[model samples]
Target: MKQQTKQEILYRFPDGFWWGSATSATQIEGAANEGGKGPNIWDYWYEKEPNRFFNGVGPSVTSDFYHRYKEDIALMKEIGHNSFRLSISWSRLIPGGIGDVNPTAVQFYNNVINELLENEIEPFVTLFHFDMPLAMQELGGWESRDVVDAYARYAKICFELFGDRVKKWFTHNEPIVPVEGGYLYDFHYPNIIDFQRAVQVAYHTIIAHAKAVQVFKQMNIPDGKIGIILNLTPSYPRSSHPADVKAAHIADLFFNRSFLDPAVKGEYPQDLVDLLREYGYLPVTKEGDQKLIKENTVDILGINYYQPRRVKTKEHLPNPEAPFMPDRFFDYYAMPGRKMNPHRGWEIYEKGIYDILMNVKENYGNIECFISENGMGVEGEERFRDEDGMIHDDYRIEFIREHLKWVHKAIQEGANVKGYHVWTFMDNWSWTNAYKNRYGLVAVDLENNRKRTIKKSGYWFKTLVENNGF
Candidate 1:
């Protein structure tokens, strides 16, 4: 085989391309219960079953961003970061998720936002990041329509509190992850396996997003944009057979179109609605929901693409007696000769990002978008020790370079992409997986007072951002 050189990469992004890193409050901020922060779902869940987490680690012992944010921001500026994305915990703001505001938490967030702006770094703030307040979860969570209203109110409070400094606001992060992890996979809190409940939860989340957008519009905040972050997984057929094609289409509808259409177009896809009606799994909707959704679509989009789905027709027939299942119509097929992430067992196909951008451009009106979260996750990464007590993560550098090449290609082909933010800034506690998978340019040492060290990828990313491409 012939070799392709770096100059062979044909595309370059526009001037002022945003190159930064992202992290959630609950994942990186270790002051879990301090500063008037009440219990979130993660805190409550960990208290119940500590063994469920990897290495028995929980959010209480995270990257310690609460105390080290000033130093971290300095590092961000030193590494050529012009922007950073972070989330505000709902329970931290409103302990009961609905009642009075917490003064200490308010001051802390204001300080963080003001500090970011003072340092000339744009802050992208997300409202909810899979950390539902325990009080709200007890009230039927997303399964009840009332929770949707509560979420909208919470979002409005955030806008009123932080909209002056935070120009870009995201309603939710990976909305479908809760439906799959909390409802189907039994990996998250309130774990259950009911497709009907899952459909309802998904529906309510869309409603919450629409309501939040409506509130934002009502506020009329100048030069501010509100959007939702979606994890778009492009689907590919195993073969050209009619069954395989149909399976791929259905999978795409379920995974991508289910949330993308409503967030972008203000309406769900007709095919997805038809499938739900056929299976009697359609979520109950109230009056005016259709109009609300149609009127308040997102002003921007955040795409988080990690991998694609290779699907084939299901070999087994549907069982009438069993509860509804999404995989009943299609089966996942592991592609032969596909590149793999040895540390995390995930497929690495750089083209998936390009295909995702193209799909959004062709089918979703080419909305303004950016890569919200993309990175390689490694398990037990501490074993890669060196004489200097630093991890030489060259593989991570290669992973990001391959993905950026595809993103650059998509931008050249007129895909309306604006920026790229890696999944994290430093290794922190993941929700259920805890600290097992490290997806960060900066490594955090959990021992010896939670120290942070820049990895090789961090240096590479700094130069890439400085040059706008490398």
Candidate 2:
């Protein structure tokens, strides 16, 4: 096969396109017990059951951003990152999740924010990224209405502290992940396998998002934009059969619309509500929740597209005794002949990014959006090292380039997308998966006291971001 030149690339994004990476506190900041940081649910969970994590790794052994943020920010500048996204650990700020603030943690975050600004890097800060304080979880987590108010208080505190420097603020990162991981999928802390509780958790999360938006608006911070990050998995049916189509629709309703509708459209899908009602799984809501959601929808949306969901008609009859499962009406189908991310076991469909953008444009009113987290994860990446200490990450480069093409096409078609940020800045400890999959432009050498080395993809991304296109 003949090689194609860069000029022959099909899609090119607009000028000033943001190209950076994302990381969360618990994933990268390893000072879990230091700087007056209280134990989050993850810390407590890992302590109780270290075996639950991959390789027995936990948050306490993250990239140590708390100590190395300055060096990391320098690397970000070197890699041509004009902007970056990170989250503030709520537990770090307020140890009990609702009381007095931690002065040391506050100073630490202030230093990080200021350093990023000094380096001319735009900081997109998210308020939450699944690291709830154990104290808060003890109060029933997202299942309690009071916890929503507590979250608002936490968001307000962050706004007051960081809003002056951080222009872009996100309320939550992939809110549905916690509901699924914690309440249904049993991957996150406080893991439960109850569908009713899952629905309630999802419901309360939306309410919390709306309440945070309300708080943000009330704060009157200049140039501030508050939004929620969603990991949207575009659902595709197996065929044109009505049953297959219906299955796809329900899948979309459960995974996509459950949060998308409320965050963007300010109302849950009627079908979802009906399904919950039929099964008596509807979460309790206050009188003013609908109005609050409608009046205070997100100013922007962060789209994190890693895969697509292909669905078909259910293979088996629904279990009557099972408490309200979303997959009861559909079956997940692995499309044969589809490309796959072998390391992560996710189908790598580039067009899924376009579909997600189009859905936001057509159905969700084209709310301001960006690719918040999209990247490939690899297992045991150290095997690719060479004599020069560089890892040839061409696979990651191809993954990003293909996805950026779709994002570019969507923007050209008026999708209102602003930028793209990969899943991570460097390899960090994921909750339970815990360093099993590395998704980073710069690899961290864990054995060498957590040394950072820029991979080949880092050099490639520097040029891509500097050029604003590939």
Candidate 3:
């Protein structure tokens, strides 16, 4: 009788679960200059040097969602998207970051929001998604306090305009990407290599985020919630040795805790502050910043987990004459026996999602959060197309399933996990990657009028959303 009573366990989520994908304005919306839209860093950078982008294919030739958003929204509905995350282009909305609101741009966003509502899809809107208005960059970007003030004003305007209808708002997405890609790595626009300047940029971004939260709270949009989306990469020490442990701690301070602490705990790590001060590389801060940050904390968190960072103790000392860098204290250690994603060369670590959620639950006051972005990017996917003209992307299906299993485990263990949103809904131009890597459930034919077709994983996702479980 006991054996007969046993049954398969169902990994079901709570009611009103959010099921969707995310996309940024610059990556999806073409018509870069239409509808009174000002040039952003991407637009200016492409015009200045097209070769910098992948295959010299700039943002101008994206999926043309500007003219096809209605059709695109319907596709989202068909895919069973109850909620979706979309960033509002600062360049398009305020046109130069601090001027009059463009009526045409306003109308476009209004229509998009209404369409989503009409389709019963909740809109998760982000204010800035790395598409800095070119005009703001001219004034020193985030390095200057003026840009920070302008960003606060822009956040206020967005709340006033759309906060009434759009309850979920995000200040910025992956704020550290600019510091890493632009200043440290030279992968983003206005590329430079300066540790001191990078410190300043990162500091100003925190200030800007806190200020935005303050404004959002003041507006008092009914049931409105504001948060920051951080791409949290957990640091694992190579061994339990003191040196390896110290190296991992430093890396975590530099990458994860830099934003996580202030965003959640409303405080910066004392050790990091001491290190910067000892090195004489501390970024400038103003009076009342401590108070401002403490008083305004996020109501939610969006964690974008792609890969984990593995670090080992440093063997070589840095040259006294060489420039200061984050890697000076440690080096990345590629684990010999780790799962890998050969398609894109990223590590296949599904448990990283559970690790992140558990960390948030244990260390960050159990903040309400979700898997905001997770997906596989496979190039040359066209070869997998069948005679039926449908893509059988089993690799993507497996990737998502493995990750969702961990998510289910986390939720069952009480992680306050809210939902799971993939990296994107459709294949669109990446930042400088262009169309080289495709990470979408729907494939866009780059050559054939940018046609859209659902991949195998998309159909599976629709079923998963409808069933709320596998």
lDDT of each: 0.89, 0.90, 0.91
**TM-scores, in order shown?**
0.97, 0.97, 0.97
Lowest lDDT block of 10, candidate 3: 1-10
> Considering only N, C-alpha and C atoms within 3 Å, which residue pairs clash in candidate 1?
none
Candidate 3: tens digits of C-alpha lDDT, residues 323-408? 78889989999999998888678888899888999999999999999989999898899999999788989999899988999999
Clashing pairs in 2: none
Most lDDT-accurate candidate: 3
Candidate 1 lDDT by residue in tens digits, 304-408: 978879999998898889767789889999999999998778899999999999998998899999999999999877777677877888788898899999999
Q: Which stretches of candidate 3 lie over 4 Å from their true place?
A: 1-9
What is candidate 1's local distance difference test score?
A: 0.89
- Supply every candidate's count of residue pairs whose N, Cα or C atoms clash at under 3 angstroms: 0, 0, 0
What is the Cα-based TM-score of model 1?
Answer: 0.97
Q: Write down the worst ten-residue block by lDDT for model 1.
A: 1-10
Question: Which pairs clash in the backbone of model 3?
Answer: none
